[model samples]
Target: MTITIVGVGLLGGSFALAVREKYPKATFVGVDASPVHGQLALAKGIVDQMKPLDEAVAVSTLVVLATPVNTILDLLPRVLDHLPEGATVTDLGSTKGLICQLADAHPKRAQFVAVHPMAGTENSGPGAAFRELLPGKNLIICDREKSRPDSLKLVEALFSDIGMKLFYMNPQEHDLHLAYVSHLSHISSFALGLTVLEKEKDEQAIFDMASTGFSSTVRLAKSSPQMWAPIFDQNRTNVSQALGDYIEFLKQFKVLIDEQNLKDSSEFMARANQIRRVLEGIDRK
Candidate 1:
């Protein structure tokens, strides 16, 4: 089988590596805008060859779109324009609603399967990819019924082969839930990083005084802005709502602290601690 991985960044490169383990004979082609990323992908054995998007996708049995959400928006139609009959197309884009809506209008809609693998790190590029990233991760498959059974089955089996657990949801649910769970976390991290950087003019002081908790909390701030900016834009409504809700809670907490109400502040912290229980239960699952 010939598989084309568009973008060849972290998710795309990692998918190529993991899927190769499952289908050793499968040949991989990479399509990337960056000359450096294309060269790195080839050098790292992430792909057997690198080709322009149109040429590589024209002959592919499967094409995985792992570019930013905005790029995916522009490329999906063109990808469908070049897709071979009966071939499958799937994406690892974080936002699903608009992508799915766009796919729905295409004549080759049934050939596309919309997916978001709930995995990644605050890193970009093919060099940051590792085969282990997808294993044991949760993958959300949206609008499953809209896809051809064969196309859907092919994607499902491939993700399963790579050791990912699958879940199903509509495009609306996928975007809304992810806005709160994934997007909000990154936004909070970025805010925390900016807050500290603004207040602590002394970089050395920050480095010395930073705790592991602060480091972990701020790590997502280092994520690629090129990738995340489009995600926040694509899912703006949901993300905006999530942020508004979050800001309200911050306001409430500030009120408690400003009044020096130790009792209220302590209760707020105690309530916040429940997240630990929630996360622990999820880990147990």
Candidate 2:
């Protein structure tokens, strides 16, 4: 099959590598706004060739929109308009509700699949791509019922080939769940990083004294603002609600600390420790 990937950054480039592993003979054509990224992807052999969006979509058996959520919103309908009759289209955007709503009334809505692969690192660019990124990861397919059977089957096969397990949810539920699980973590990391930078000021001291805990906690803060800003904008309401709840918990913790309630703090920590079981289950998978 001939596959075209738009936005040949980390997600797109990694996906190309994964697909190439499973379907070694499939031809890959990459499309990106950045000429530098396109050239790098070609040099690294991430894609067989690069082409204009319209030209690439015209010949592709499957088109993967691996761009940011806002870019996906703008590109989905245009791709559907130019896609061949039997071709399929899918996206790897983090937010789903807005994109799904935008395509709800399209004439060829059924030709597209809404997917969010629940895996990535705090890195971007073609150089960061790797085949192992998707293995054992969960892939969420939103509003699967809206997609044509053939389109859904094609997407399912593609995820299966890349060693991912699938979960199905309506767009609304997917967005709400991700607000708490994914978006909130990035917000927390960014806030923590900012707090330390603003207060500590001593860059050398921070670098010298930082431990693994600090590094891991602030890791998501290093993610690209260009990509995440659009996600926060698109899922503003849900993410706001998640942030509000998190702030309330922080307030409660502060009250506990102020009161010197050691027993209460221990109980609260014990409750949070229950997350270990949930994390263990994921590890086993």
Candidate 1 lDDT tens digits, 142-212: 99999999999999999999999999999999999999999999999999999999999999999999899
Instruction: Give me candidate 1's TM-score against the actual structure.
Output: 0.98
Which candidate achieves the best lDDT against the true structure? 1
- Write the residue-wise lDDT of candidate 2 on 1-285 in tens digits: 999999998999999999898998999999999999999999988899999999999999999999989999999999999999999999999999989998898999999999999998999999999988987899999999999999999999989988999999998999999999999999999999999999889999999999999999999999999999999999999999999999998999999999999999889899999999998997887
lDDT score at residue 130, model 1, on the 0-100 scale: 97
lDDT of all predictions: 0.96, 0.94
User: Least lDDT summed over 10 consecutive residues: which range in candidate 2?
Assistant: 127-136
lDDT of candidate 1 at residue 144, scale 0 to 100? 97
Clashes of each: 0, 0
